[model samples]
Target chain A: MKGVVFVKLSEFVEETWGLALWDELLQEADLASDGIYTTVCVYDDQEFFSLVSLIGNKKGITVAQAQKAFGEWIFTELYAIAPPGAHDFVDIFEFLHGVQNVIHVEVKKLNPDGLLPEFDFLFESEKTLRFHYKSPRKLCYFCEGLIYGLSKHVNQEVTVSHVECEHNNDDRCVLEVSKVG
Target chain B: MDKNPPPEALDIQLLKRKIEREQKARQIAEQQLEVHSREIYQTNLSLKKSLDYAKKKNAEIEYLTKASYDVSSELTLFDILQSTVALTGRFFNAAHGINAIFDGQKVQPNSKPLIWSSGGFWDQNIELQSFFFKHFPLERAGAPPEWLIMPIDENDRIEGQSFRWIVCINFELGNDSSVWIGFLSKSELIDEEALNVLEIAKGHLRSGIRRRLSDARTVRRNIELQETATHLEDARKQLIQSERMASLGELAAGVAHEINNPIGYIRANLQVLDDYLKEFKSTFKLIEEKVNLTGSLSKQEFTDTANKQDLNFLLEDAESILKSNLEGVERVKEIVEGLKSFSHAGDDNLKQISIYECVGTALRVVANEFKYQHQIINELEKTLPNILSNYGQLQQVFVNLLINSAHSMPDGGTLKIYSELSGKNLLIHVEDTGVGMDEQTKNQIFNPFFTTKPVGKGTGLGLSVTYAILEAQHISIVVDSTLGKGTCFTLGFTVD
Candidate 1:
């Protein structure tokens, strides 16, 4: 996990709840970086989940909801890291398709130390785009939230579902995104 | 409080963002640099591999080129095979080699097993010969395998200069014949690439051998042609002499008549002379009686006896008959002399002789062939310089020319024989104003058995024999003929 993810999350927390709440979550959580994250550094994966859980508890929500919201909130910030052709996708499905081919290649070049997920596609139909997401991190919910954010940014209607899940002991997660009427 | 920070605080925030941006840019640049370096390293490695391959191929090409030169430089098949053995022995890292060939004539080939070795040529070993034939059989049932490997006396000994292992490769030509190149070494020589190159070298070797063999065959055929030419020369000379006598035989009737006419007259005149001798004897007896008995006889009785014998007429007629008989005998002798001179055989020694004599003898022998319609204009210069030539053969040459000319003029054309002087050379021209030949026939006039006369009318060897005889004397002959005009044969003799 790059520190850029944490930095984007902190900005999202501070912008929504104010700097005071953001600091309270960071001070309470045991972070090696003391929650002073820089984009160029790599931090512990558990530390990221721990901070997300702490914020979820304070807001009286489930950890899944908080993580999902954080993924949606931090989408625009992470979108900045995408290489040129990954932007301006016509819809959320197009953006998801570009994630593996266009965005990930450039991301790997920039942060080679980061363990990126393997992305393969199955064009089940013209409207339905199914992609197999295989990663040790198993961030399926976060990926769903990213899709939700991308749909809003591109101003197109989309429905996201999963035919298989890593959480259910499948080797990879197959997320199916479809255009909505 | 304002949502925007103070100017000093804004400056610090802007500076932090600037530092992070610069750090990220530097990291991407470093990543690109490493990737490019790795690619360059891989390219360098590939180029090195390609260079190695090219060097190996170049070495192979040079080796085959050297072998080609070796194969071509040698003149004989044995030498070529020997040279190939030397080249391949070193190339395949062998200690010894043997080359054998079968010439397809007989099962027992002219197989000289020329062994090449680092030491020298073949060191003859009777045991090795037996061992070789045992492995490579003389009458193997089918086409032999491309290669064969067999173990030699494997006693690990180099002192006796024998190999432990041997590889025999066979290059087969047509006619169940092949050239076998066998290499021997203490260790196995199993370089496949070298063997592949050896196959290409085999092509050069096969053609080189083919050329060498073709050369050898040509030389052999040339010798045979020379021998045939010699035999033909001898036969031709014999035929020329025979033809001289044969033509005379053809004229035998005319010659016999020329002799018989004079003999018939001389015989009749001798009978008369005998009678006259008897009459003179009677008269002499009468005279003797008159002188002895009365010492004087009457003129009336003498006159009466003389008139009874007709002495005046006998005296005049008998002298005339004796003179004519003597001239007849001389005519027979001249014809016989001509026959003897014309038919002299095998006397091909050159002597200084003029063309006029040859023409004269040729005319006398072939005179009966001419007719009242045929005109013999012997324009041969009597004072022509004498040239070196065989007398009998030259006369036969002229006889053949005259007969051919006479035959050409079947309807009785002029047969003009003449000679000219040109720069210390004598040129005899035998021309006929008959049905002349075209350019094509004129070109082949001197070739053997080439003639315009019908099948049985000509042997076609007249001008060929004449040309051969003249050629032997270092003389030149040319034919100038045109259709419906005339044909002339010019013999030029360098007579300085």
Candidate 2:
């Protein structure tokens, strides 16, 4: 009941990284859903999940590849939102380790500007969770969007976004997400 | 027969051989004798030559030694001069020599130098006199003999000039022996080269003259410095003593004021006591008189009671005793008030103070000394304005004068103090009819340490200190006195 869910990757990326590239990526991957569908990302030390269940028609890749792809996408999203001038993967890892809860993905057709999301996933912990994303240019933008989306969805603005690991491969992704507000 | 025949031929051969050997030995002996004779001849020739050369060298050394001894022997200026003339005359074979010394004033020829020479050429040669005068200028010349006159200097000024010349009959001796030397008459010529020898003999004359002049100035300066130091020391001592006396005066004033406060009350109390005692005695006396008049008593009983009490005499004596005690208390109070006023007189700053106030304060302070002894009469002008002065110092001046006046009067006398304003000056006069001072004593009265009082009774600095203080403030004091009659001191100061 408390797992993360993404109804649409476009809405999720728009709210997290503050970019519309996620809509293009979702259309290319053909992963769009109306009902709630859950996407889960598991790593060696930590795990994350998103559930999307279709209300009308579901168009996307297989669930396994979607999960993997979501993992890579989330990794890229974490890198985009990471702080500027962060060189060491460990520093990014520690930053992501802090936000263990309070992260969510949602899709909403009524909000044209994507100003509001349906669901928000938040990581909650005493320590900060840090990670690196593939798109280094969009790290700070993504982190700022994530914080704004989390503050708007939870009505609690005291959430922190962090990077968990180095994003060395475009296909393989790593992230540790948490919530602090 | 054959041997006899040949004898003559054999004899001839033997003779020839013998003769040849003998001739050879004789030739060798003759050559050895010739060598010995030549060696003896050579030795005699060398010995004779060495002896002649040694004799010649010994004579030359003796002459040189004699010349050196003769030249260095003359040390003093006179001796050097005399010997130079004598040696030159002897060397050049001249007849006479004359030496003249020139000073800036005159040229004096040495008499003994000319007298010693044989010829009287000095008297004959007018050219010599003119030559000497022309060459040896009176201002700058000295002992002369070598055609160059050397000036003798003491402290870098030419003091004397000596001229030396030879009177010669002929010029063969090259003008050496005819030299004559003379020195100036006014200044003594010292031998410069023989300073060590001549200095011992003339030490007293030169140094004595120099010291006499310098010592006089040194002695006068030393005396003046000593006198100044002594005066300064005396002033220092007097200043210290005056400060002490001022402090003592203040202490006495404070004590007097403190005593006056109590004595003032005590005197009042005693007056009341006296009055009450008088009233009690009078009442008691009246009762006794009334009792005696009204009551009847036995004669012996009345006599006994009268003898025991003596009420009439007791009443009479009580009034006198109370009166005397009250008078004594009043006297104590008066003395206290006088001391207080004298001590507190000059607490205020300097201003134009009335001379009368100065006199009053001084008299009050010394009132005990003058109370029953001398009568002070004040003839101060009522219209006289106050004079500008430090009030305390003025009071001190007045006190000194008053005390001096009282001291002069062993018995009782009159002291008249008066002041008047003349032009811009205030004249204060203290005249006393006491034992006056003679001229000698009065002359030295203002000198420190000159006192008539017995030793330890007076420091003798009071009048001199007062004189100094007054003089420093531009005030003058004049004294008029006649022995056995009176003395008056007038103090004058410029008014503001």
Candidate 3:
């Protein structure tokens, strides 16, 4: 069956882990699909473990053990299903390509309408992004939907893949995506 | 062999299709995540911006509250205005500010609003306008900037019945605009409060002005009252002096007449005695010559000489001198008695007194006043009847007239006092041949305080008091005087 999976985390545990854990986790992990593991760890700490047990009534582990398990899982299970730009190297390349297309098509469409489009998005790894578009309404409509879809997926707390687009203003076909966990 | 290769190629195609589907799903999730991250970042930025703005707003409110508190602290009108202008200037960052108050008629911009601000900033020629307008050329003109023109209104109405006021506030450094505050009522500017500071100030100004005006009026009225009181006091003193003089004049006149009668009889008697003494001396001389011729004469001859000399006649002449001196003494006594009666008449009842007797009594009292100055000529009619009157006051009136007559005759002259019996009335006249009064003097002669004599000599109240006395007794006195000739004062009384 094809379906989406969702998980609600404790807000307190998420805040306690903060942005520092995300940065360190992203830097050290080797995210590649080798089919050697099954589960991935997002945040780990003694406080987070206790907080999770209180909220979910699950077993707990120390931060050091969870960090080692998260690194091993990223290289195997999480990478297995991730798209082409799931890792940093592919994600940066896809994002630059997507930004160029968005800027060109939206600016061309918005020049006649005298409106600037603004938007916000979130990744599955709890990373936020913002943008202001000096763009036209027709192009901004698609960008707005795409950014909204990305924020919805991030709310589900899952990993994502990155991709680039081939279409410009003349063509309505474009492919742009980035991975976050 | 061909069938086995076909199945393997089909399996590879299915796997490629599945991988494409999974990659597309992953791309969708990544886009959603990026969008959510951007939204959170934008929300955080907006929240920070709003918090900063609120902090600044609170600071501005605090500053305004402190400024208003300081402005209301002053109590006096001038101080309040000054502080209001100063605080408003500081708040708006203006250079110079001025408050001009109105007088009733016109706006005196240059004049200091109070006596205390004598040396303060005062500017004239400030005018009221609908709005503060900058003088700009038509080419550069557009919709002008808005100016703050707050009018100080007393009764919530502003228009024709408004006070004249003009306030000019200069711009601060690097600014070119100014704010103007004015009032519709002069009184509305008091106490520096929003409700009616100007009105209270105007009220104070009006009260101050009114107080000054009333003070001046009171001072003028007091001066007038004092002058009137002094005049009244002087009149009273003169009245008293005149009455005393009149009594003195009456006494002098009466004594003069009495002494004249006695002196006249004594002179007559002395002349007769002188003649008798001359005759006796001649007879004695003859006897002496006869005795010398016949040396030893007989006693019979001496007896003949004594009989010839008439010794009884000499004794009779000596008795006559003694009798005449006694008569002179009696005449003096009569004069004294008449004076005493006239003076004491004030204690007696108002009765029907003979007109002749009244005249004589008055003459006796004023005998000394007219002693040598004038000769009194009485032309009293024998048929003159008595009149019902206050004897003392009537005597005083008579005496005043007679004395006035004597005074008129500075040099010796004849004073004629006469009476005529008319129907039910007796008209008595006292006339003097002396320097008479002119028309002007005569008109005011009976007016109290009107005097023709030198100061300190005559109090001029004599005739006036005399007129009053006679009038009180229901009698009338009329005077007729010819300048450089003589005067006649006529008294008319009703007979019982």
Candidate 4:
């Protein structure tokens, strides 16, 4: 995991729940990073899971819900610093396609060793898009939330369905998204 | 203060942490820029190398194109050698050139090479020859390769031009000579690219020399063939003339026979007349003696001698003999005149000669040939217009035809000669009912060296000469023949 993810997640938690709750979650997390993350450095992924678990325990939510909330926050935060190409795509599907294709390629160049999930896409139709994903982290809920967050940014209504998830019997996750009528 | 810090103290601590995090992010951003800058520099370096290689290759291609065009355009070997050396020097920045041409194995002759400096043509040809003789003698003839590069000989630099290395390319010139075109470089070694460019020029020069030499040989061969044809033509003309002489000889023999018959009877008649005159003279002489001059006998003696001589019968027979002798003399005169006209070999000027007269003269020339073996049929029109033609040549044409007709009738077949006036033309036909030729033989009868007669009996140039004479007169001949029946030769002489 890249330190940027941790830095953005911490920023999201502090902004949504205030600095006192973020300080409390950091204290309880017992992280290797000690809740100090910089965007250029790498950190242990387990420490990231611990931080999210701490946030979930303190906020009276499951770890999946905490992770989903962090994913949504980071999507908007990342778009605020999006490249010129990302802003050119007006539709949610176009934006999501650009993120995986254009943005991810550029991002990979910057952080080649970052533990990013690999995605294979099928634009089943103009109205539907499916993302086949595989990762050791198995962050299916986080990717689903990222799709919902992109739809929010474009003000487009889309239904994100987990056709298959690593958490279930499936070996890899397939998220099928459809535009709302 | 309470157990937790007050708002001012907590806000100061939070402000300090925010500043520290901002400083750290700036440091990381600067490090990323350095790594990206190194990668960008590497990519630019790779692109530069590729562009340089492409440019070098393009130069080599352009050089080869120009070099080949320059070499191949020259037709002569000397011009090709000079042009190739000049192109090589200009291409590789060479300062001077030297070319030598001589024979190697006759299959290829090297271009006689005199070292040509950048200044002008080499005037010292003898000196250059001596230099090559002293160094690369004829004994070095092992049939060298197409190209060679050697260090400039320190022993001999005739003009002393400070030439570094010499690149010599050679190809065949002619059977008697070889050619060498050498480019003299300056100080520096030529690079691989320039060497590759020279290889292309070598290929063009090799084939150019070969093609130009082959072309020269072809031109020479054409001239030789033309000369041979001219000699053959001269020989054929001479043979046709000999054939004409042979015809004249035959005519002479025939006229001799005709003249001898008339002369023989004329001489006998004269001898009889001489004896009768002598008797009369003796009787007269006896009377003259009594009257005047000698007075050797009496008048009565003269009367007795005259009475004994039988004067009336002698006088009458003498008149008949004298008349016969006069007719015989006229016949001999006519035969001699005919021989004179037929034997006029130089009478070649075109004139309006009567076709009937020409045929008559020809028949008379060969009259003896026809007398014993063949029957003659002459139905020629005397009123036919005279043709504008050489009299002697036409005479030769008609005589050859009449003789050939007579010869064909070996076992006494009919010989028929006639004339007809077609539109603007007079057609003379000579027919024979002898051994006639087939279509193949008929077609070839007029060709030189074509003969149906026995080898010693015929020169085979008779009809060929006839055809040549007719063609010169712008007259056409057509022969119609059947194997068993007869043959007719029609000469169509256009009347002017």
Every model: Cα RMSD to truth? 19.6, 46.3, 30.4, 13.9
Q: Which of the two, 2 or 3, has more lDDT?
A: 3
Model 1 chain A, TM-score vs. native:
0.90
**Tens digits of per-residue lDDT for model 2 on A1-181?**
1112232343454454433233334334443231123322111111112222111124344433344434444554454443443223333223333343222221222223332222122343444433444332223333444444433433443433333323333442233444443
| Tens-place lDDT digits, model 3, residues B1-496 | 5756675575565445435534654665566567768977998899889997776555445445544454444344345455555444443333334543433223234644321112333344233222122211112112222222354345533344444222332211112211223322233342233223233333333343334445657889999999998997566445544575556663564477668778888888888778778777877787788889997556887777767887667868778797988889877876777666655534324687777787887776677677565788998865678788866667767777887777788778999988777788878888889899899988999997787777766657777878766765778888899998999888888877
Off by over 4 Å in 1: A1-181, B1-70, B73-75, B90-93, B101-117, B134-164, B173-175, B188-201, B223-246, B283-324, B344-351, B368-381, B388-390, B397-418, B425-494
Candidate 1 lDDT, B1-496, residue by residue in tens: 8898887886666456546645664675567568778978998999999999887788778778887987778557767777778777877778777777655423234464655666766665655554554555445423543556677665644456656777776655556776767777666546678768877886787678778777878999999999999999789778776656666665678667767778898999999899988988888787778768888878887887778777778888889988998898887777777778877785678889877887787787777677889998998767878888887888878888778777778889898988888788778899999888888888888787787878755567777877878888888888888788788888888886
TM-score for each predicted model, relative to the true structure? 0.49, 0.30, 0.32, 0.50
Ranking by DockQ: 4, 1, 3, 2
Candidate 3, after superposition: displacement of residue A15 in Å? 99
Off by over 4 Å in 3: A1-181, B1-246, B249-310, B368-375
Docking class of 1: incorrect
Task: Find the candidate with the highest lDDT and give its number.
Answer: 1
lDDT-better candidate, 3 vs 4: 4
The Cα error of candidate 4 at residue B220, in Å, is 4.2
Q: Rank the candidates by TM-score, best first.
A: 4, 1, 3, 2
Model 4 TM: 0.50
TM-score of chain B of each: 0.62, 0.39, 0.42, 0.62
The stretch of ten residues in a row with the least summed lDDT in candidate 3 chain B is: B170-179
Can you write out model 4's per-residue Cα lDDT over B181-217, one digit (the tens) per residue? 5566666676766776677667777777668878888
